[model samples]
Target: MYVGEMGIDRPRELPWQELVLGGTAVAVLLGLHLLPDSGGVDPVYELLSEYPLRSVVVGVPYTLALLSANTAVVLLGVAMVRQGLLRGWLTTTLLAVWCLSLLGLTVFLKDPVGSAGTWYGTAHKLCTVANFVSLPALCALLWRRFRTVSGWRGNARRVGVLAALSMVCAVPFAAAFLRYGGQLRATGTVLGLIERCIVVLDIATIVTLAAWSRAMAAARDKRRFDHEVI
Candidate 1:
């Protein structure tokens, strides 16, 4: 149902939260990747988990990684509020859990890439699994909300669905490729490439959501303009 139908007041302009959050995130990641002693190009290809623990191990890069990741997830939480998708306590709680999952992966880094037996390594794996699993669940919950918003229909709908599906398949695809293709080692390998692709796909979904929100905000402004002019 429309926000108006529910007697809710809609915002006049698009929320700039996503732009700030996502842009800062991309910049931090790029900056970290470009730092000196960052193993040059070798570290770039390896899984990101290998970076703070195994490779580089620089404090600035490590901290920035966590900050950027958690900040970006704020956009996901605010997206619903800006779009007037807030339903009740259930929606709010789920979104909180989803955001926490994203943040959990940043806690303390891992026990290096090879030593999953360590306490920190175990925590890292749990967080990683939570992040991957919770992502699709968030998308699923947002499905109905997406359809309710007129701006998210048509091509935007297809884009959103495809993006979510890509995320849903990413972990499995990476796991299978790692198991059958070869060992999951540093960069320049199939596993590393697949993992990078998954990151790209995740960013794509975020961008798509931002675009949809902008469209909705624009449409709302135009409607209000017409009403005023009339």
Candidate 2:
């Protein structure tokens, strides 16, 4: 992949994408939650929240601490993108940039050059909206890669399909479940628990898969050595 005409080689960037998305979603939720005791999330309140979402609302700075923190995380993703996978990484990186830029609008809200208020909110919403598009881009890449993988894994076809679909929906659905989850959930903590579980479970699964693959390769080597000695 080329960033400003520089070539970058990244490997297994799906994990990176997951990390960044999870971070951004969590940051936004936490930021809003920490604000002085707001009643249960209401549409009218949400609308009002957006009204003052600029950098200089009432001549005071907005709470951009979390948003800026997310931008730093996004930059790390960009920096790390130079390692084997392309299709998933490329699409994900693009979506991430867009999302970060939307959030960035707030940091510049008061500046003469910066966009603020509803415009920034609209852009932020737009970037979040584009997340659905990112899903398809990643799915296509995974589907193509799946087609190429040597059928070494049992049920290769099924695994490929599932991976492609799971990755695509992971971010977007999680966002929806998070934003509106309180209403549908019996307890507000359910979504939080679910998010934590998903993060831990997914990371553990990927690490386990990597370890298993290495073990298989080692076994293959040992068998070859035995045959050669015999």
Candidate 3:
């Protein structure tokens, strides 16, 4: 079936791979918080980037998590293109930018909390902003595209919810950062918690889309087999 220029047929099934990649990302992210020597950083006010700046133990896992998450997103984007869930060069460009921004995170370490600004830190901040903005925008576009498709309506709803939740958390996160001029500790806000929530939701969105694509592909294959047998 075709919806405008988007094709929704014969989706490829690769949910397990995506799950493995995304799961690794989430697991490492969660594990960072439990590290005994995590800089004595306050999870409520400090950002996840603080861990690497404080402890070498956290840095390796943090880099691994970002790499894993980036791979998962790249795979998901390819699947979306194959399944016709994403259309147009504009969306494709956005996805590429998002993936590159994610990769930048791994390459450029964030500025240490309350440290003098450096060139790498500035680049990292730009990448962070681009990563944050692009994913939600992509999700919004996907939700609009998927809602009308027969097999994708449910996935559309799931994407919508995840995107909405991430955006909701982002408002307070941004507000606190701005209100304190990026001094989150002085703002006394749960910036870390809020950022964590957004990351979790974004990961969930990727997994949900992967699972939905797998299910739809399976259903399509079964129907084709049954027709051939008959």
Candidate 4:
């Protein structure tokens, strides 16, 4: 059989269009969530709690956005696995844990102000911790692997350095949250801004990995075709 007929096709890459749709949904919904006065919610100090968005009057759009974001993240992991870009059982496990953490955060809303120590509140905190912790751990664990991977080395090194810094920053952010989050008040603080910066970094890390995986897969596929033709 001719090569085109004989060669098995690689699993299809996840379309970037899908990722963009998911990302846009997340961003727009989050912006809307910030509207609605939040009943004097200090966006700076309020932990970006989804509780406000879950309101009866204006919750639907925010809920849809969150679910879309969740599905996008989970789908990204699955795509990496299918493309054989993630590598190893440990890597796969960490990816799955991170995705599960995202889902958990969506399903378990945090307690409202003055109700910080409630059961659901605690559950929300646990999910938050797990989500944040798993991300850095995954980055650290994959650093060396990426550094050595045939086509992904350079991107891996850059991501690894960023990952280490992000983990270090998470320490202070978590501490600050625990200490002052109960107050649910931060009128003139940069801490909330810092927290948002961390969120940006986290999103960057995920996006970088997705892009890297697709690039590597495409390169490999091209090389395979070239060899077959030669």
Candidate 5:
């Protein structure tokens, strides 16, 4: 019997459109740091949110990049669900929370460094924490799911590694905030550097998952083609 006739679900390929969108978002985010209007803030000491407030040049692009990234993530999550990679409501909820937190980051910009926190700023901080917390949890879930599926163990290990790195990066990021009593001006800690590393790993994890789905789809097609030829 064919794979489908044997009650196996074929992997759902992530669309090229989603990959392009995600790639564009990553490019834009990385490119933003190169702009001349960055307000002279030290990247190692300060947070990325400080950039947008520094100038309109950075603000507009930063907002657009985040929105694009959020959209790409939502599309990817849906693809994973259809592919049976996200098998339960718990995983679905985690994906939703991560996406929503990303949206919140765009909507409620953090307060300027060393400034008093406003309501929106407080909300922004909450969302930042949520975003950091949720993505790694989702990666852990994906790792568990991928480990059991044939042809997916490599990706499972990759995702597990990314999740571990994310958690490790979060340590210093969190410590900097806690040391400052939840303030953003922890100059002694490499808060910006750690945050940047976490962001890169998070994006890399998403790309890895997308690559896994695409690879599975290709392998499934090849198996079907061979079965038909035989």
Candidate 6:
């Protein structure tokens, strides 16, 4: 049943504590993305190229980390939504896609081609774009849809603002992807400043989502308190 009919109120977002922690985790991942790797092609991939790690040691541990972290964040987002939070789905989905993207990166990292430059480069480039640049776009779309689904009236203007921010944030990475992606420099598909800008957008989006979740929770709590007093 809809909370509106049940006398249960939904908050505008989740609690502040949740928002801070969740936002911080997202930021750490973002930092990992921004961290310069060997100052060239992904260091993880580069090292794997020289010597593949034992499946037991590297592969299993990495996979577990990716899956566990991603799942935890997704559940946290869901919990927020369950308590009348909004934007939780998008946040959950964003974290999931990102974690999956990292998991996807693990594949390329372990099997980077040493002899064939162009072919391996292309594959890695595509994965980077898909995971790094495009995933944010997916997240943004989800956030917009989530807001609409929240059934919050007169939120068109707010949604519009979010849409605009997403587009603006996308510009840098999009350009970087097109420019340095194919270049066979030492960097090998490593994007420059533009990519960093896209990451910044991702960071902003994460924070915004967290805030939105917190607001939803607060609103719900307030409504419930008011009813008990009356």
All candidates' lDDT scores? 0.57, 0.40, 0.73, 0.68, 0.77, 0.48
Per-residue lDDT of candidate 3, residues 1-230 (tens digit): 21122233543434677679878888887777776744456677787776667667677788888889889889888986776556798778878888999898789877665777778887877776777777777778888887898877888888888878878887667555544533677776678878877787777776776666556656666676656557
Models ranked on TM-score: 5, 3, 4, 1, 6, 2
As for TM-score, the candidate ahead, 2 or 4, is: 4
Tell me how far the alpha carbon of residue 58 in candidate 1 is from the true structure, in angstroms, after superposition. Answer: 3.8
Q: Candidate 1, residues 129-213: lDDT per residue as tens digits?
A: 5665554555555675566756455634655575566665676654543343322453334555566666666676556655655
Model 3 lowest lDDT segment of ten: 1-10
- Which 10-residue window of candidate 4 scores lowest in summed lDDT? 1-10
For each candidate in turn, give its C-alpha RMSD to the true structure in angstroms: 5.8, 11.3, 5.3, 3.9, 4.3, 7.6
Model 1: lowest-lDDT 10 consecutive positions: 179-188
Can you write out model 6's per-residue Cα lDDT over 20-69, one digit (the tens) per residue?
A: 55455454444444545422334322322222233343444444444444
> TM-score for every candidate vs. truth?
0.68, 0.37, 0.81, 0.81, 0.83, 0.50
lDDT of 1: 0.57
Assess the local accuracy of residue 126 in candidate 3 as a C-alpha lDDT between 0 and 100. 75
Give a tens-digit lDDT track for model 2, residues 1-230: 11121222223224455456545655554555455542233222232123243224311322343354455445443433432222355755654653464454344331121333355444544444453344344434444554565543442344345445545445644465335522323333343333333333333333333333333444444555556557
Best by lDDT: 5
Candidate 2 segments whose C-alpha is farther than 4 A from its true place: 1-28, 34-36, 39-66, 87-93, 104-125, 146-230
Of the two candidates 1 and 5, the one with more favorable TM-score, higher being better, is 5
Tens-digit lDDT string for candidate 4 (79-153): 788766788888888878877876776677666656537776677667767777787888887787767867667
Q: For model 3, what is the alpha-carbon lDDT of residue 114?
A: 70
RMSD of 3: 5.3
Which scores higher on lDDT, 2 or 4?
A: 4
What does the lDDT read for residue 69 in candidate 4?
Answer: 71
Task: Using lDDT as the measure, name the better of candidate 4 and candidate 6.
Answer: 4
